[model samples]
Target: MAIQTAAKATIYRMVMPDHICPYGLKAVDLLKRNGFEVDDRWLETREETDAFKAKHNIETTPQTFIRGERIGGYDDLRLHLGKRVRDPEATSYRPVVAVFAVAALLALATSWAATGSLLTIAAGEWFIAFSMCTLALLKLQDVESFSTMFLNYDVLARRFVPYSYVYPFGELVAGVLMVAGTFMWLSIPVALFIGSIGAASVFKAVYIDRRELKCACVGGNSNVPLGFVSLTENLMMVGMAVWMLVKPMGVGVGH
Candidate 1:
């Protein structure tokens, strides 16, 4: 009964000995999920796939057609179905949000396991430390890209290009030191310095200059926006640095 009411859709996909188009499978799945009665057509050879493309005057395969109207590829089909498609070039905080979320969960889990409690002063400390380390690792993955992105708004990086390369390593060292509850003398200064610079840069870029751009916080190849998330990261570092410095002197709030 559901099949009788389903929309008729046609899909042309590649299926060969050495290659099978993943998009074709995705298209088929999408169609089925959206109550489409799909007429799955396969181009069984490379020549056949190329010929199909030439015949349609299209560059790629895994094409979908609905009721004799070409719906294009997997992304195009999604758009036709009114599904939200993420644009690669669009600014987003999703990556940063995911990183922080995972970091917080890890902190909570570890704290609970060690101290037999979910909420602890150490949990908050662990969250910030882990988040910093994770973000640094991401930037280190492609430092060239990260440096290029960092230079856009960072005043220090702009003046001294070497600072861009050094920033991730500094963050990593500071985070590791804080997590281990050691080397406050070294970690405090590094975190304070970088966090201060970062906060100023973000404030100038987003609030003062009002120049919209992608953040280099997660890495060079991210679409994270240069605003609140970036500021938050810097603020967290600053807070952590201050806490670490004061805790040893018996002047801080947390244990």
Candidate 2:
């Protein structure tokens, strides 16, 4: 019986005196990681690179081939290997999903460590608080930009411009206070106010006005769509606020 060898791929990439194609290096790394035997070819000069491009009728370097068939550039190669290719302008929920997912994990982990239980009322509260803090941090990264994007849809923020600038801080304060469980009087009200305004604004913009926009829930520069995820965030805050309001203020303090 003959022994089988790894799959083979051929890549032609630029490695000039002043510039090396980063995609070329990335392509090679991907091939190696996925158990492909790569034949790396370099175009060491601009003339050589241009000639190769003309011959192949391609516009970019880091051109790849599989089994002697031309497979286009780095992104194309990624598709061939069943990898996700990100579109820069496309709307997505990945950032919001990631924030919520990590927050839930942290809450669960803390619950288990502190009380030897993962699914407690405290854990649920912590999850919302953590999500609020993380989302606020993202907005605070570029408050100016976040506020600008925020005013596009937020009814209260547009009416009171300063509120746009202060929104992230309010969220952060509410979240921190909720976690500490010492200032429920302040935190619960802040959470209710902002969350109510946010939910109303999002509903009017997306449902009533039928407008298309990006969400500032994660950040201003984020490509997340202004829809379900945005509404969910505000609703979560409101729900947490109401829950804490009904429960004892000292219930989860320092837990």
- What TM-score would each prediction reach against the true structure? 0.92, 0.84
- Scanning candidate 1 in windows of ten residues, the lowest lDDT window is 246-255
Worst 10 residues of 2 by lDDT: 246-255
Root-mean-square deviation per candidate? 2.5, 3.0
* Candidate 2 local distance difference test against the native: 0.93
lDDT by residue for model 1 over 1-255, one digit each (tens)? 444577899999998888899999999999999899989999998889899999999999899999999999999999999998888888888899999999999899878877788888888889999999999999999999999999999999999999999999999999988878777789899999999999999999999999989999999999998999899999999999988866655321223
Candidate 2 deviant stretches above 4 angstroms: 1-7, 14-22, 33-35, 42-59, 67-69, 81-83
Model 2 steric clash pairs: none
lDDT of 2 by residue, 1-255 (tens): 999899999999999889999999999999999999999999999999999989988889899899999988889989999999989999989999899999999999988988898998889989999999999999999999999999999999998999999999999999999888767789999999999999999999999999999999998899999998899999999999998878874566364
Candidate 2 structure, TM-score to reference: 0.84
Highest TM-score: give the candidate number. Answer: 1
**How far in Å is the alpha carbon of 133 misplaced in model 2?**
0.4
